[model samples]
Target: MPKHISLISLLVVCSLWNMPQAVHAQALIPHTLQLDAENLERQGLQLAQEAAQLGQFQQFDLALPRARLASQLAPNNDRVWFLLGGLHLQAQDVDAAMAALEKANSLNPENPDIFFALGSANFQQQKYQAAADHYKQGLKLKPDYREGLFDLGNAYYMLGRLPEAIAQYNKSFSQDQKFWPAINNIGLIKYEQGDIESAMKQWRTSVEIDKQAAEPLLALAVAMYNQGDRQQALSMGEAAIRIDQRYANLDFLKENLWGERLLSDTKIFLELPRIQAALQQSDN
Candidate 1:
């Protein structure tokens, strides 16, 4: 199988393994039975919010059942399903997240955040085409939805439609110039297309926009190294390592640019032969 496909499959399997079972019907019961259902629902929501704020993902997982019960108690409140969907997303239960988010969307179709979450779940699951369609629908509903545009650009990028990716990134950046990921992704696409100068310019702009981000620094270094500017490349590469020692593909850069500095960087050396083969297969 193609490497990326294999990798994705492996990730899916691992995620499935780690996923908690769908909360059983019995699990949705509240501890204290009360006639004042609205008050009980309000208390359940408050607990859910507390769990989310504490970053207690497992607690959030447990809290979702109560939230759903609360929704049952107060069938008219849209916030109950919205919170349930957000909690399911935090739990990485995509199917449940989609269901709850769709329910929330039905209640509040004009809510851009619901579409954004649905788009995000699809994107994470590698349903690129579906993600793009959802993002497009979201943008249609809310023209300045920067998150939708950003994620839509990501879907296009993963599909290897670089021009479309760039257009989406540009649209996202127009809404918020400080959107570092889009800027970094634009640089990445230019680098992949062999436009080293333009790539470096974009990466530099990205770094200017978000000084703490390591991606633009690493990408700029790679672009510089590819263009034979070893000194500047080493400088930027070292800077990136200092910012985020665990930056992805740092070892790949070091290996490719060996006989130069940054050799001691403790990043994973991506096998180029494998990468090239995967790219070739993707093109097919």
Candidate 2:
């Protein structure tokens, strides 16, 4: 029989394993514009800063008005356009965000960050092909741009090009090893490829990196359960619930664990002792 671990231990381990990345990326964004025309630019810049603060606090409704005013005040400023685009995105106004981001990209074509943001907006709108194109363009402008590479990986994943997605994710992870999303995505691809043990290892690594991240924890639990580790699975599942009880598809996971018992009885039958021997050999 497998070891019987408590749900609490599982939760604690999972939580402790997954940690969030630092806010370095957010710091890279320009909070103020410095145009030669000092007064008008400063006024617009101040409004843009206020809008950014609002957006940061998830006050999208409040942010949009200020962002629009700033854009109106500094119509030619790429930063203003970018802020407006971000506000529109927060409001879930995809069309407006796209228009504003396009203008921003046009104004600052060399700025890979703007292109990455535009690609993200496109991805959110289900424009995977266009998102991929924009991400590729952004990468060309700024090689080793981890965000652009990650978004490109997601675009490829959405398009069902798992191998390409995996490749892009690998590239992104190489640049920023602590990026949890890329690690989780790679585990997902591995799981889909029927490499259960490898997938489990990757998911475990993700959880080790950031236990608070619900996605990888849930995925790891599912993988462990599928491999006939009921107690471990239950623990992981419970940990996921603890992290975010409102996480999407929680019901589905619960149903599988309690109602279906789909994971508990997955057969581990082998045809020959040599096959088992080979498996043990590979483990070694």
Identify the candidate with maximal lDDT: 2
Q: Can you write out model 2's per-residue Cα lDDT over 200-236, one digit (the tens) per residue? A: 7877888888879877786776667666786766666
lDDT (tens digit, per residue) of candidate 1 on 82-122: 77777888888889988888888899888777777888788
lDDT of each: 0.68, 0.72
Count of backbone collisions within predicted model 1: 0
> Which pairs, if any, clash in model 2?
17-207, 17-211, 18-210, 18-211, 19-209, 19-210, 19-211
For model 1, state the Cα shift of residue 103 in Å. 2.1
